[model samples]
Target: MSKGENTRKRIIAKSAELFNQKGYASSSLSDITELTGIKKGGIYRHFASKDEIAVEAYKYAGSIVSGKIHEALDRETTATGKLLVFLKVYENVVEAPPFIGGCPLLNLATESDDGDPVLRENARRGLDNTLELMKRIITEGVRSGEFKADLDVDALATFALSIMEGGIMLSKLDGDNRHVRSNIDSLTAYLKTVAAAS
Candidate 1:
């Protein structure tokens, strides 16, 4: 990468971290400059505005966590195993998150709900991608006879995502992994109920 490209990435990384922790509205350009050690002019040279930086930073943050989840999912051969892996990844993140703070999608969704339209849309896309992944897995499971034939894939996917995100939020707020672990346990039990006979 060129020097300019490298600098832009550094700025995005630092901004993502700050945005995850302090939120976009609270994190200032000065804070990003301080963290990145790049002057204001340098930052502006790469990003036209804070909004632009925030969109890129949010995408960067989402990719970090999403990449990990995809890796975990790929390791499982069965749809049931893939679902379990998905839940387990979130459980692990409660203890050792891929990014600082917590889940980027959850953070950005809540932070931008009443604020930045760009960020809100980005967050929504991130969430939609996750739901789609889960839906695909469930749909495959049903077709393969690995899961119940009559399962409501879309509804279940939405429920699972909500449970996972809620668990993360509670775990982060309480400063304990038990909350997420409990949710994961519940998810595991629920998955078993949906799984077909061996």
Candidate 2:
């Protein structure tokens, strides 16, 4: 890649960590500059504004998370297996978070909900993307006869997302991975009951 392109990506990657570690409102340009070792003018050269950087950085982090989920999905053949594996990804959040801070989706949503207009929308979109993925998995499970056909896909996905996110938040706050791991186990057990038998 060209020098300019590399710089842009570095800015995004570094800023993503900064924003996720601190927050959109809490992170400053100087903090970004210190983290990236790039001058303020250099950063401005690549991003028109800090908001632009935040939006792009968020997209960058989101892409990494989405890629991780897709890469690990091939191990499961059944729809329910795929969903469980997907949820298990969160089990590692406490030990090995996708980002420096934690789950970017959760962090961004909690902090940016009423902050920056553009950032708030970006966080909302990130949330929607996750929910849509869960919904898609549940829908496929129902169609494949792995999940009960009569189950409410929307509600199920929402419940699973809520449980996982809540567990993650609690674990992060308490400095314990047990909370998330237990939630994953509980979710797996619950889904198994709803899954169809051989």
Candidate 3:
């Protein structure tokens, strides 16, 4: 990569961490400059405004999360195993987050809902992508005779996502992992009930 490209990526990486922790409204250009050790002019040279930087940073952060999920999915062969891995990944993340704060989609969605349109949309897309992943897994399970054919893929996917995200939110708010653990247990039980007979 060129020097300019490297600098832009560095800025995005630093900004993503700051945005995840402090959020877009609270995080400032000064914070980015401090975190990246890049001058204000240099940052401006790459990003036209804070909004532009935030959009790219959000995408970068989401990609990190998506990459982890994909990695976990790749490790499993069966659809059921993939779903279990997905839950396990979230459980681990609750106990030890990969990022500084927590799930960027959750954090960004809650903080930017009514505040920043660009960020809100970015977060929405991240969430939609997650739902799509779950849907694919469930659909595969049904097709492979691992899950009941009558299952509602869309509803189940939405419920699973809601349970996971809700658990994360509660766990973060209370500074305890019990909420997430309990939710994971419940989800596991639900999954088993839906599984086809061996």
Q: lDDT of each model, Cα atoms only?
A: 0.88, 0.85, 0.85
Of the two candidates 2 and 3, the one with more favorable TM-score, higher being better, is: 2
Model 1: lDDT equals 0.88
TM-score for each of the candidates: 0.96, 0.95, 0.94
The runs of at least 3 residues in candidate 1 whose Cα sits more than 4 Å from the true structure, single-residue gaps closed, are none
Write one digit per residue (lDDT tens) for candidate 3, span 58-144. Answer: 888888877887898898998767766655666755458756678888988999998888888888888888889899999999999
RMSD to true structure for each model, in Å: 1.2, 1.3, 1.4
> Residue 80 deviation, candidate 2, in Å?
2.1
Q: What range of 10 consecutive residues in model 3 has the weakest lDDT sum?
A: 86-95
lDDT of 1 at 118: 86
Per lDDT, what order, best first?
Answer: 1, 3, 2
Question: Model 2, range 1-198, lDDT digits (tens) per residue?
Answer: 999999999999999999888888889999999989999999999989999998999899888878878877876777766766655776767678866788888888898777667888988888888889889889999998888879999998898888878988998899888888887789888988897777
lDDT for 100 in candidate 3 is: 63
Question: Total clashing residue pairs per candidate?
Answer: 0, 0, 0
Candidate 2: residue 118 lDDT (0-100) = 82
Candidate 1 — worst ten consecutive residues by lDDT sum? 86-95
Better by lDDT, candidate 3 or 2: 3
